[model samples]
Target: MISPTTIDQVFETARVEEVIGDFVQLKKAGSNFKGLSPFSDERSPSFMVSPVKQIWKDFSSGKGGNVVAFLMEHEHFTYPEAIKYLAKKYNIEVEETEQTNEQKEQQDERESLYLVSEFANSYFQKILHKTDQGKAIGLSYFKERGFTEDTIKKFDLGYSLDEWQAFTDEALKQGYKLEFLEKTGLTIVKEDKRFDRFKGRVMFPIKSMSGRVLGFGGRILINDKKAAKYVNSPESDIYHKSKVLYGIYHAKQSIAKEDNCYLVEGYTDVIQFHQTGIKNVVSSSGTALTPEQIRLINRLTKNITVLFDGDAAGMRASLRGIDLILEQGMNVKVCTFPEGEDPDSFAKQNTLEELSVYLIENAKDFIQFKASVLYEESKNDPIKKAETIRDIVNSISKIPDRIKKEIYIQECSKIMDISEEVLFSTLAQINKKDFKEADKQYKTEQRAFEVIKQQPVKKVDVQYVLERKIIEVLLLYGNRTEGFEDLILKENDKGQLILEPVINRAKVFEKIFLDLQDDEMEFTNPKFKTLYYTIIDTLNQNPEFQLKNFINSVDTDMANEITTILMEDERYALDDWERMHIFPKEKTQNVAQLVTETILSLRCFLIDQKVKEVQQKTIENKNNVNKSVLEEVKDYSGLKMLLSRKLNRAL
Candidate 1:
């Protein structure tokens, strides 16, 4: 547990952008910072962070939260751990209280994983420096690759001994837990057997932004054709390869300072570039460029100069990467090394100044470079030439900025000797077809929960729909304090009792809770019932409700459920609402009315359901129709009519 004062101090000190920027790459999008989602693999940035509100929302994953929540979700930190992390980040002293057993367990598990990883890193480093095999094989191999001792130590490079159980046995003898070692992928355990996962390999420690060792990437030294050349840490609580960049930990500052990032394809490319005093560089670790990796660079810089190996396959890979970058609306320039040279080898051969000049001279805009290379290959065949033109046009269409797209189109027309109008037509068709496909996918996805519209009345499951509506209302408006009109009996001028409207102040949750209790109504669905009470309890406890904080605090499933309900009504909401001269009324404008109407509709539904039940009972006892059953049907019918009238609906 953490003291409230420390929590408040942490919140006040930690900037949301500064904290989240350490993880996901964020670029300014209007008033908010938008980037690729760390929670999911996405090309376009669906993850948004609002500096003003100090909150973040990942539309792709339906996760939203305050800064603390972001840490909790992204780092898998416990609430107290997240608070402490921020406190440490901001240099705030923490005042603690005793934590529950659950917190202790969670904290212990995650901390151990990190501890074991760091220990493994140190142990491997010791072997590299102290042992005979480490020196003769690993040290010599690095020297041959042109890496100096200082460079080797700076990057925390290490060597794993050839024997399988040597590393595992040493780890356990040091009092480290085998569970954590296996969890961090330093060791593999199966059916009471344990062995080092990276035996006889050179180890590369993968680190988080703040420089904590998360996992490792190891390269095999021996000439065993059966084994993979490189093996990465498997996905675990601490490490996700897709969400990490190879040299981000080292290059973040330089990338931000230079306002440009040099992207390469291998670890050596990144290390060699840094050794040459060119620090704004990272690698995809032999994996194809991912949106997550691109956004990691996007956080520090918008401009990416992709350094491609001078080979046929590298050119093809470059083409694929360019399209993904364009889709992210980034300024991308492609630079290929001379024939038979790669970024690693090229950097080793040239001085920093020489390499920098070469990059500047050789760099070309994606459109021009793509057109020139793609055209040369297809110029002989007219049919292939036509396909190449479309391919270039397709990449241009990926640019999110209309101006950029148009400029690229004009450039393409000149290079291809085609008219701008024809190019524009091709771009429009590609965009329209893409739009239709997206729309169709969206419509298909919407079928699971579309408000029960277009269904027969008898098949509608009206009770379930009404129950969902109640939960939605509570989640959206529960904390809103408003003046609600209540009818009270009053003596008029004639001294006769009469119904008069009275204004009373109450929270929306209070009104709904009281009304539901008054009628002994409850949600039928087990999930909805639990969720309803959770929302009501949460709202009741906090008079000033913070939706993002609440969403971040709850479990993932609950947060997702709440977000789904909140986002559903806005499913049809057009972003061009003002441009289209259309505006929908805000639910906030009438919180009291919305609550009243939702409750009234629920009562009416329940009453109608009761009436049908009674009528069914009467039919079952047709020979001697129960008098009480007839009155029951009549009473339910009259209640339904009255409720419908109150709702301004025909009975």
Candidate 2:
């Protein structure tokens, strides 16, 4: 129900790069910016952002759109949410039409879940700051862990009351359904009894990349023998713990600014580091690191440093994560704390500078860290040592950049006391094995898809010719006041002013556009009805609509289509062509240019003929020498002169 004026503001203010840059780290690549694909696992960057066009396109994923579309695709935001987010970011006032109950009922389940989760986040946060149970339990726990009031508020940390159904009572009173509460695992329903799921536990709300709260992780206060220490929201439409990392919402900016992400294993680890002035840190929250999570981090920064407790098991568990990070085309380094120390304890015990210095001095490359950790475990046994070396090399092979792979291989050989050639040989074998398997998988999927390659639309013949002529006229002279003669047509021996079958180029476009609204049509095909509509819309909007603007608005998928329609039937080098008759020099260029212009101009005239003929034929068939049809031809004749002027600009 957003107003058209507000929607226009959102579109105007939401710069595509500014919005998408929040989730993807963009680096300048020629005229465009390129980044790793957020939707896929790719080493080379295939995601492109065009600031001039106000759109982003991911070649790897085949998704492309303007700023709102990017938000819809990347963060999975609803159209209204995306518009509201842009408005907030750009500080624009939003005016919305009132929604009825039926309109509210039309919201999808996924949207409903997002709304419920967002409401819960606000509810929990209010309790933490306002209620006695929250202040006494959650605030105390965070304070005891060395978090300041500012840090606590920044993260929106909160708690659920000890009494069962406390949150449920408030939610239900607010008209939130118990079913959604149970579905989101906010209120556990057992034996037909519903109660607040996180009763008495401090809250940790997990947020999506765009900062909407998707779920929660809560910790209990008492050391109850029967109760689990921590509980997280169950998997739902909006929340997937395995695919999300804690503190990402807060740390994404810092990570991008610093160009490195500090990866930890607990919520406390994130708080302690941020409290100590290191803001580019996030936690796995004790879940095993996943490629999806790593790719999420990869989208923000290419460098990741894993921080682990000094325990042997913790360090070993971190090794697997390191390999996955490498597989994601990221430069990874590992930093383990002093024995018995973790990020939380270590940061609390030391100054920010001291902690940072320790991390920097102790950080080791993935291969060195792996070799050092496993070398002792293997205990100089030849087979065990060889297996360890191969394992490290296999991880190295995962790196997509050849130069980086070579450097790591060289470093690994030096650290493991093995020959460089041996590691290189091992890496090649592993890479070949992986490549073959991937190729086979891709071919299998492609074969399945090949079963139904969609058929192409039939080429537009006369209608296309006519439409392009009108579009060209509208593009160049829609608002211009040019003198016109009122041509008359004789109908039943009576003479009257003529109007074309579809006169007023803008009106003609709108009528034809409304007539063709198929969703399955590919806009790339020049014959596509959708393509004609798209072009017509652009032509009708701007009084000064030019060919360049039309070309700029389209994505690569439609770029050729627009370009072909504009240039193939429109002259660009008429002046140069004229030069050929007068000049001794520039024969090749002038002749070629003349040939091109002749072809283009003839095409335009032919299209105009088709438009006139179609209008004339329709009038003749009706046996009414239509007066409107004569006026249409007169208006079109005036447009033809303007179009010729546009084409002969150089003259």
Candidate 3:
């Protein structure tokens, strides 16, 4: 358990810009820093880091938080992990108290899997370096493949001993549980006996983007005909292969720095590329590419250059991945090495400069790559050529950006010697078919939700607007002192009613709270009601409450809402209105008026609702014409008139 003092120290010392800059590239934008959102694919900057507020907001994804929250959200770190990461970053020594037995026992299941995976990774690395068999076999294989000792260590390459029970026995002896070992696929338990899963294989530790070991991939070096050449960890609580990319932990920063990624098909391809000084590279780890994998890269950069071996299988894999990349709206380029060499062997055969030069010269846009590869296969067969042209058009249709699709379509038409009009017609037909299929599926699903159609959604317009405005005011200027004016009804000496004005000064939150209390008003929106009370409670406890401090204490949804409200203008600050000599007024400048108007508007809206309800009741029971019902309707109508008069609105 980390002490409160350490957490507070971490929060105090960590600067939002400095912390986020480690993951994102931030350029100065007025009082804040702006960059492309790390949470979404965007060509323009929408992520903002405010040093003053000590918070960051990615407008693209509607995610925002303080430094600790950002780490937790972006890196998927647990609370303790986020704190520890910050502490390590800022060189702040963490102060901890020992967890009780109960606390230790209550640790989450996913975290236990992470612990076991980490232990397995370390254990395998130790064996690779410390044991005779590991050094002779695993180290020899890697070294023989032209992998440097530094590269081997950097990627945490290792070797599992050939003996069936070697890893299982060692893990059990070290107090690591067998259940987690089996869950992480490091140990295989069978019929009251246990054995290591990756026995006699060279280990490749797979890490999450934050550098935590998620699982492992192992390769068998022996030439046994029956045994599979490669094995990967099974899907587990902590590792989902489809959601993770190999070398992403090491490649993320470089990917962002270079504004492009070199995607390959295997672990060695990624490692070799990194060793050759092209750090922005990741592999699908030999799995067929998935939309989830493309989105992972999409978060860092919009550009991907896929490297393929100059073989039929490699070209097929490249073709399979390109459509998925385009579906995610990423710009993809393709580069194939010379015949008889993969990324691993090719990088080894050439110097770093030669390898870099070859990649630059060989890279082709996806449209061109598709046309050229498919054209060669089609030869002069007109029918086969037509099919190839349709295939290329289908890939172009997957792209969501209209301008990018148009440009690619033009290029494809020229390369395939097809008319531009014909390609456009084919694309429209494909899109129309897709839409019809989607609509049919949607209608089928809608039938299952027939109950929802029975009760139509009612619009709570006035209450929603008024409640949200109140919350925005409290979040923005709740602590500031402001002067407020109130209108009161008074009797003159002649017993005539006259309006009187009274003025007072108080904190904005206090003024608003008192006004609501005087009117006996409350927010009708449940979320708004909850936020209102929370803000009031927080301000009562700490008069100096800040937005960042409040945000840090709330749950993610509430924090995002607060950030969205606060950053609404900053999102459009790129317009630079001040430079045009058209300075916008700050909300705080008229805080008291805004607060008073919001409360009065809510009150008037409520009275209007009451008037309508009473009138409906009167109509429903008009045959009886009860005096009490008439009086109720009259009273509500009069109240609405009085409130409307106070608001200076026409009745």
Error of 1 at 402 (Å): 10
Q: Global lDDT for candidate 3?
A: 0.86
Error of 1 at 224 (Å): 13
RMSD of candidate 3 to true structure, Å: 4.6
**Estimated TM-score for each candidate:** 0.68, 0.74, 0.84
Candidate No. with top lDDT = 3
Candidate 1 at 412: error in angstroms?
4.4
Tens digits of lDDT, candidate 1, 1-651: 688888777877888898988766677654567777777745566777777556677777877767877887777766777888888878999998765545434657778788688888999899999999999988888889999999999999999999978888988887777888888888899998888999999988988765678889899998999999999999898887886878888998888778899989888889999998899898877777888777667756789998888797668766898899888778999898988999999999999999999999999998788887888889999999989999999999899899998999999999999999999999999999999999999898789547576665666887888788888878767777899877666999999976577889998889989999999998898978989988888887888787656665677667656666665554333143545777767777888887888788889878877878877877887898867877877788877766766677986
* Model 3 lDDT per residue over 1-651, tens place: 898889888887889888777667677777888887877767678888888777778888888877877888877778998999889878999998766646644668777788788888999999999999999999999999889999999999999999999999988877677888888989988989889999899999999877889999999999989988999999998889998899998998899889899998889999988999989999999888898788778766789999999897669756978998888878999998888989999988888899889989999999888888888889789898989989999999899899988998899878887799999999999999999998999999899778688788887687887888888899888999887877788999999987788888899899889878887887777878889999999999997798877887888778777777677668766566667888778665777878878887888888877778878877888887778877887887887777677778898
RMSD of 2: 10.4
Q: lDDT per prediction?
A: 0.82, 0.75, 0.86
Better of 2 and 3 by lDDT: 3
lDDT of 2 by residue, 171-198 (tens): 8777677778888889888897888889
Error of 2 at 390 (Å): 2.6
The top-ranked prediction according to TM-score is 3
Per-residue error at 280 for model 2, in Å? 1.3
Better of 2 and 3 by TM-score: 3
